[model samples]
Target: MTAVLATLNLGVERHGPWTSVGRSGIDKRPVDHRVQARTWGLEGDLIADKRVHGGPDKAVYAFAREDAVFWQEELGRDVGPGNFGENFSTTGLDVTGAEVGEQWAIGDAVFEVIRARKPCRVFAGFWDVPDLVKRFIAHGAPGAYLRTLQEGSVGAGDAIEVIRRPGHGVTIGYMLRALTTEPHLLPRFLDAPEMLPKHHEKARKWLAARELEKSNP
Candidate 1:
């Protein structure tokens, strides 16, 4: 199945009431090629990482497809690349199922799903929803963070196809849910060999804690 973009959204700097603030221009329907050029031309490759600004975290640069829904309903519009502050907002593909190191080809560019994004205060500030962060954590829909594996041009209506899938069966959603809801059970989820490096770190921490408990007891 192909994941079609139901909405695309974007935000730069803003703060206000949650519902009202969320209804801004950040979430709107995809514009024609002309509109895309004016509002989202920078979204193309080479400039995709411009937002990162050399932060320690890579998640800052991009967001996954599922997270765009919040903006979609908020703005009462079909948001896409130009609206979501993302260089490439896509649909049609199970993002949660995308494994770390696996590559995807969208139009002429290629990107890798690196890890699950961790929402920051900036998101809360933008939406003006105090509980937004908590809700994101609770829902564990942090969305997938990606790195540009290959750079090229991309735009709306472009077909996204999975070029590879990791041998590991665990999905990004499965790991995020485990981390958020049942952190204590994280080790069990790491049974899959394909778990990403971050998940490996979590598993190590859990094992260490368990070992400490055994000795202390």
Candidate 2:
């Protein structure tokens, strides 16, 4: 399936409780001269890829259309329950199956799903709803974080294609569950063939903890 940009939104950081952000653009007509220029020699402008920072639980996650549905149903709105920075909001693609290391082509740009996102307390502040963080954990709509595999332009109406899948059956959701419910299980999760380096370190810590537990028990 192909995902077309149903909407294009952008926002600058604002100082406030949970930050009052709003959509910057909708379906507006392109200027004729600009279109003519692009039709001739000028190339189209490239959309910026969103970035995430901070720890796992406090990390920002971005979702396309289908994933957005999960957030709306779970959080009762289009945007998530945090001041999550999502520069490119997409539609018509299922992001749940995205695996780490798998490359996705959106227009000329290629990005790899690097990891699964985790929710934080900022979510509750954004929605002004209590226990929102818990709600996100319960719903499990934390979107995938992607890194640029090949830099190129991406915009609305770009098609997304999965170039590869991890050899292991383990998914982002599985890892998140393991991290939250059974931190001791991190070793097993890391053994997955597709485990990233960061996860490998986490597994090592878990293994150490497991050894300590065994000695104490």
Candidate 3:
């Protein structure tokens, strides 16, 4: 029910050929002190691509510190906190298992689980791994993209407190799978009202397209 914020990461604009925007906030570095957490995003966090990277629905990304250990073992390297481009690297909570619409309060900030991270071409480019996106998708710990519900200060070492948890069983992992490799499970995400509106639209559109294909075929 509680987790410690292991690291708070913020980044500056960095040029990269991974996106048409030619910039990325993926190169984040850990911040030891508290930072402002706003509805838009962290105060000093770098967001070069508003369209693809930062927005209200994808405000603050979080990854479990425990999951980082798994990657360390799998990749045979030190996958430390903030290495995954998450704003908060945390402990004692299942970030991947976070249900859509789940709410958590840490320090002065409150957040809601809006969706899961979509590892695109930029993600692979950031890591310099051609198959990074595929590997991350298969890992099933894609991390949680959170929407800030309240403006507050968030820093490392603060305890994350869950304020509300939706009963819907659709988690970040399930949402990612449904959106990517598992079309058969799309119904689970589509029917969950707690899911982000955009993702709900995505699943609904995919299902409609499929139905149309069946009829036309």
Candidate 4:
């Protein structure tokens, strides 16, 4: 069976107390029509925190519907597609365990997985769960952040074909762990050349800090 790119969602920043303009794009809702997939992101999608959230490297955020099901069971609440502010909600896609450089052909657009999503305050606030950031880290289904390699229109019901797999064995799941609880596994994250440049730099910084601490202590 083929994986389905089930839904496309978009949202604009709303007024909040978080930033000077209080910007957040977490209130994504499903679009009934095709959305234009561009190099930066879905056309008309408003990203309040462009500095971190939206860019070429993270042009699209994809969450697996299976992971959403997990959340539904854990929270004992309804979690539907686009509930997590992801641009793409997929069914049957193993994004959590995918290689960093995996390529996907979704409708007319092609994307390459670059890294994993890291939970932050904006996400926690959107869910109204103060400890959500911590909880999400523990859950560890951070999803895959993909870069648009070929831009075009992508809509719901598109078939997601894995065009290529990266040379590294570093799955998004393993990468999330290495960057979080499994600090000692930093070396593994470092070894993956397909990893997002910022993430690679972060792991190095973290490892360097640990070494410094050990030396000082």
Per-candidate clashes, comma-separated: 13, 1, 0, 0
lDDT of each: 0.53, 0.52, 0.86, 0.85
Residue clash pairs of candidate 4: none
State TM-scores per candidate.
Answer: 0.65, 0.70, 0.92, 0.90
List the candidate numbers ranked by lDDT, top first.
3, 4, 1, 2
Per-residue lDDT of 1-217 in model 4, one digit per residue for the tens?
6799888889856666644347778878888899888899899887887788888988999999889988888778898777788999999889988898999999898999998898888777777778988988899899888999999889999999999987678998888898788877777777788776777787788888988999999
Better TM-score candidate (2, 4): 4
Quote the lDDT for 217 in model 1.
Answer: 97
Q: Which residue pairs collide in model 3, if any?
A: none
**What's the C-alpha lDDT at position 112 in model 3?**
94
Positional deviation of 212 in candidate 2, in angstroms? 2.7
Better of 2 and 4 by lDDT: 4
Give the residue spans of candidate 3 off by over 4 A.
Answer: 209-217
Report per-prediction Cα RMSD to one decimal: 6.2, 7.3, 1.9, 2.2
lDDT per residue (tens digit) for residues 37-130 in model 1? 2222324222312353212224213445666687678546764554334444566666666665566666566666656655555456554566
Judging by TM-score against the true structure, name the best candidate.
3
Candidate 2 lDDT tens digits, 75-166: 56655312344434556655655555566765666666666667654446645677877776666656676665555555545566777776
